[model samples]
Target: MPSAIRFSGVSRHYGNVKAVDGVDMDIAEGEFFAMLGPSGSGKTTSLRLIAGFEQPTAGDIHIFGHVAQGLPPYKRNVNTVFQDYALFPHLNVRDNVAYGLMVAGQAKAERYRSAERALDMVALGGYGDRKPSALSGGQRQRVALARALVNEPKALLLDEPLGALDLKLREQMQEELKSLQRSLGITFIFVTHDQGEALSMADRVAVFNEGRIVQTGTPEDIYYRPEVPFVADFVGSSNVLPPEIMRDIRGVDAYGALRPEAVRRCDAGHDAWVRNVSFLGASTRVSMQVHGVAMTMLLPRGAEIPAVGSTIQVCWQQDDLHVMSR
Candidate 1:
């Protein structure tokens, strides 16, 4: 498949600061791809580069086989949805959604019709008359989506679009956003620090760190087979076992990643001293010291919870232990 967006040796530097440094990526057409990382990791900068909001210091950016670098945002066939929604309080939802078309010299009748169709796509069909202040946060977010979709861009660039919503609302929107992307069959480039949001909504993910992509793969590949320690620790809180621990367990002088949930309670295994037990709704997180190394295990619901300060035997399947390459 052709690429919706491509970056070749892309770098955006500010004096000594390299916000995006020598990054190469190919985002496929009609794919839902996520750039996942913490703040200042260059994920947001990458999105901006794609949207033409920021220019690359040295490299090429191609959007649908056309050179996108140095082009204005309006010239790129892409739309951006920001976290703050950026709605106009004075205008009604219909007018707000049609603002882009209005600016493009579209007539009132045509722009309003396009805006209404976009609003319907976001399930806000009847909210055309509502003002920005009259709607809730989620509704405003949908309005933002409608506004972005009004132009029917080839790709959608989202910069933490669900960041402002509450947990429940965010979860609800995740599903809706994924569904909408599939239905629209357009490239959706989502930038977020939330691992859950990326893993749940994106078809593929690029894990970023220190202005570079550490790993890029499907969610399962990133979670189960992290190539480096940073990815293992950041993506799902996996246990980054030291080389000594791996030597003791696998007779290999290398670091390994073990999922907390992969630690099983066996009658005969390594005895672990429980240090803390945290009840987290569906599961209990137990912090333990194993062979002098502090580790954690997540006990599933309905399982017997061990009291803190107690000792228990824990074991893991060999397959569950992923030996890191670096």
Candidate 2:
């Protein structure tokens, strides 16, 4: 499939600081692609460049085969749903959604029709006349989305769209957004700092660091076979162990990573004493000291919780170990 958005050797700078450094990415048509990273990782900057909010200091951006370097946000075939929602206070939900169409010189009837359809697509039907201040956070976000979708852009860029919402609302919106994307069949370029959000929603995720993309893959690939130590540690909980190579194993590096779920409590194995136990609702997490290194393991709920300072065995299959270079 042709790329919906492409960044080729892209770099952006603020004086000497490299806000986005040499990013090369292709977001496939109709795919839910997420840029996941911490603050200052250039994820948002990359999204802005695609949205034509910022020009690249070097290289090029292409949206649907057109060079997007000089195009303004409105000229490009895209819309952005920002973290703040950015609704017009004076405008009701319908007017806010119809604003884009109206600006494009759409007829009043056509604009309202498009806005109403967009609102219904977001499950906010019959909410057109309500003011932004009168709606809840989630409703306001839906209004912003309806506004963006009412234009029927080729792609949608979301810059931390759910960052302002509470945890429960965030999760709810995540599912809603994913479902909306599938139903609309439009390419979505989502930016977020939350790993869980990306893992749960994106079809594939690009992990960013220090203004560069460190890794890009499916959530399973990012979690189970992270090529770099940063990807392993950043995407999920992992216990990085010191380099210990066994001669019999092929393609095995000296350094190893074990996910908490991969490590199991056994009656016999390498000796370890439990240092702490955290009883999560679904599972019990136990931290242990083995060979002077701390390791964590997850036991299923209802399993005998190990007491702190009690000797236990920690065992894992060689296949379960992820070997990566630092």
The candidate that wins on lDDT is 1
- TM-score of every prediction relative to native: 0.96, 0.94
- Candidate 2: list runs displaced more than 4 Å: 244-254
lDDT score for residue 256 of model 1: 95
Residue-wise C-alpha lDDT for candidate 2, range 247-270, written one tens digit per residue: 223345455677989888676777
Candidate 2 has its poorest 10 consecutive residues by lDDT at 244-253
- For residues 28-146, what per-residue lDDT tens digits would candidate 1 score against the true structure? 99999999999999999999999898999999999999998879998988999987888998999999999999999999999999999999888999899989999999999999999
Of candidate 1, the 10-residue stretch with the lowest lDDT total is 68-77
Judge candidate 1 at residue 120 and give its lDDT. 88
Error of 1 at 213 (Å): 0.6
Candidate-wise lDDT, in order:
0.93, 0.88
